[model samples]
Target: MEDVVLIYHNELGLAFRWKNTVPNADYERIQVVFRNMSFYLLQEEISKFSQNIRSAQFYNCSDCKANKSCRNILLKTPLEKMDISLNMQELSKLSDLVEGTLFKLDLQDYIWGAGRN
Candidate 1:
C-alpha cells in the first residue's frame, strides 16, 4: 500500500494525503509520521515560494476494513482552503492544528467511515 498520496491543483499547489498502509501501526508513531510529512511539505514544497498548496485533506483510500483515525495529523500551511472529514472529537483536535487562517473549509464527510465533523 502506498504510504502517501499527493494531489496537485494546477499552479495553486498540491496536497499531502496519508494512506493507511499499516493498519496495526501504533497511533503515536503514525502521528509522528504525519507531523513529519506535514513539516516537509510545508517547508519544502508548500511554502510561499514553491508550489503554494491551496488546501490540505486527510482520509483513507485503502481497502483495509479497519477504521483509521487521522485527527492527529497537524497541517501547517498558508493555504486558503481545507477539506477534512472527521468525528467531532477529531475535528476539534484538527481545529487546534491549523496555524494559518483558512478562507474556505469543508469538514463534511463525502466518504464513508470519515466520521462527521
Candidate 2:
C-alpha cells in the first residue's frame, strides 16, 4: 500500500500493471506468479481514476510482439475515440451492462462486478 501511495503521489505518470513471471520461454502455458497485492491496489487506483477520467482505454496483450506502443502519449489518435482491441479477446456473454467495456467475458460472476457508473 505504501508503495502504491508513493507511486501515486510522487510518480503519477507511471501506471503499474501486475502479471506473473513467465518461465521456460519454450513452454506454452508455463506456471506464472501473480502479484495479488499490486492487482488489488490497481483495482483501487482504477476506481479512483475512473471518478475523473472521461476518455481512456486499458488493455493487456501478451501475444503482441516487442514493438508495441507503451504509453498513451505515443498512441495515434483523433483526440476522441480510443481503440484498444489488440490484446483483448472476443467475449461471448457481455450484453448485461454498457457496451465497449469487456476484456474477455463479462466478469459479472464476481458479486456486483464492475458495471454501473
Candidate 3:
C-alpha cells in the first residue's frame, strides 16, 4: 500500500497504481493486485471483469480431496491466460471491491467533468 495509490480495496484485494506514474499514451490503467496474482487493466476491462464475476456460478467439488472446503467458484478474467478461484465469502468481497472501485472512478469523473472533455 505504501508504494501504490490505492483506488479501492477490501480484505480480499485491491486496485492501485505506482505513485507518480503518468499515463503512457491515452487511457489510464490500474493494477489489480489480488491474492497471489496481479493484473494491469483498463477501466473497461475492470468493468468486464466485474460483470464476469457477477455472472459466475458456484459449486461444490464432489471429487475434491483437499481438507479445505470444496465449495468454490471459478471466474474468468478479461485476460486470456488468467482466472480466479474464490469461495463464497471471498467472491462477495471481491465483488464489493471491484464495484466500489468503479463507483469511485465514476464519482471522480463526475467531479472533474471528465465526460465533458
Candidate 4:
C-alpha cells in the first residue's frame, strides 16, 4: 500500500484524487511516508495536486508536541485560509504562528476568560 502511494505521488504529483478505500493499517503506513518526506517535497506535492492549499483545519490537536509542531509548520506555508480549534492557551500563540502569512483565520472551541492572552 505504501509503495502504491509513493509511486502514485512520484508519477502523478497528487493530480489524481486518492480514495480512502484501504484499511487503517495501510493508512498508517502511508502517513509514516508522508511524515518522513521533507517539507519542500510535501509543499511541492500539495501544489502539484491542488495548485495551492487555500485552507487548513486543526481540531483537538493540542497536548502533543508533534501535533503543535505540525501546526507551526503549516503556519509557515503559503496558506490563505486556516482554522485552529484548540484550547484558549494555544490560541494565544496563534499570533506568533500566523505571522507573515495573510490568512483568513478562524478560532474556535476555546473557553472564554480562560486566562489566555
Model 4 C-alpha lDDT per residue in residues 1-117, reported as the tens digit of each score: 333333122211221212366444333221212222222233233343222222333334565656454444233232334322333333333332222111111111123334356
Task: Give per-residue lDDT, candidate 3, residue 104.
Answer: 85
Q: Rank the candidates by lDDT, best first.
A: 3, 1, 4, 2
Per-residue alpha-carbon lDDT of candidate 2 for residues 25-104, written as tens digits (9 for 90 to 100): 22211111121111222233333323323223343445666544433222222223432222121111111111212221
Query: Which candidate number maximizes TM-score?
Result: 3
Question: Whole-model Cα lDDT per candidate?
Answer: 0.33, 0.25, 0.77, 0.29
Give the TM-score (vs. native) of candidate 1.
Answer: 0.22
List the RMSD of every prediction in angstroms: 18.6, 16.0, 3.9, 18.1
Superposition error at 19 for model 3 (Å): 3.4
Task: Identify the runs in model 2 with alpha carbons over 4 angstroms from their true place.
Answer: 1-18, 22-41, 54-117
Q: Candidate 1: where is the Cα deviation over 4 Å? A: 22-108, 113-117
> Which structure is stronger by lDDT: 1 or 2?
1
Better of 1 and 4 by lDDT: 1
Q: Which residue pairs clash in candidate 4?
A: none
Which candidate, 3 or 4, would have the higher TM-score against the true structure? 3
Instruction: Identify the superior model by TM-score, candidate 1 or candidate 2.
Output: 1
Clashes of 4: 0
Worst 10 residues of 1 by lDDT: 99-108
Per-residue lDDT tens digits for candidate 1, residues 1-117, read: 266544322122224345667465432211212222333333322234122222333333355544555343343443346432343344333333332212111221223235533
- Against the hidden true structure, what lDDT does model 2 obtain? 0.25
In model 2, the Cα lDDT at residue 56 comes to: 32
